[model samples]
Target: MIDLNNEKLELNYPCKWIYKIIGKNNQDIKKAVKEILDQREYVLKLSKSSKKGKFKSFTLELLVHNEDDRKMLYDILYNHDNINMVL
Candidate 1:
C-alpha cells in the first residue's frame, strides 16, 4: 500500500484545481467563496450533505495561477467561519 502520510501531489501551474469545502450551510460557503474570489471566474457545485442534514459540501473549480495561488485559496477557505473542512 502507498504511504498516505508521505504522499505528495505535484500539480502544474495555471491548471484547473478543485477544492472540496464542507460546512454547516451551503449559502455561507458560497458567500465566503464569493468574497474571497471576488470578480474571478469559477464553477461551484453542490456536492452532497451529511445523512443527518447537519453538514453540506461544495466543489469549487477554478484555474490557479500557480502553487501559491492554489495554497492561498485553500487557506482562505480553511479560515472561513462556516467552513468545517477542506480537501
Candidate 2:
C-alpha cells in the first residue's frame, strides 16, 4: 500500500524547466527555440498571436531538462539578434 501524503516532494531530482519566450516575430520564436532547445528533450507551448498591421506579439513556453540546460538555452536565445527576450 502507498500513502500519497506520506511522500515528500523534493526538487533535487532533475525536472523540466519552463521558459516563457516573447518576441515580435513568430519565426524568431521558432528559430530561437530550435537553436536553443532543439535536439534536447523539451516541449514548446506557443500562445496565439494577434495580427497587428505592422507589429506582432508572440510567446513560447519551453520545457528544459535541467538548470544547466536552461542556462545554455538562455544564453543562446539572449545573445541571438532575432530573439527579443526570454523569461
- Which numbered prediction scores highest in lDDT against the true structure? 1
lDDT of 2 at 45: 60
lDDT of 2 by residue, 42-86 (tens): 566665555753334444444555667667777887778776666
Candidate 1 Cα deviation (angstroms), residue 8: 4.9
lDDT of residue 13 for candidate 2: 26
Give the least accurate 10-residue stretch of model 1, judged by summed lDDT. Answer: 1-10
Q: Please write out the lDDT profile of model 1 over residues 21-56, one tens digit for every residue.
A: 999988898999899999899999999999999999
Residue clash pairs of candidate 2? none
lDDT for 33 in candidate 2 is: 70
> lDDT, candidate 2, residue 1?
71
Clash pairs for candidate 1: none
Q: After aligning candidate 1 to the native by TM-score, how far in Å is the CA of 21 from where it should be?
A: 0.3
Model 1: residues >4 Å from true position, as ranges? Answer: 1-8
In terms of lDDT, model 1 sits at 0.92
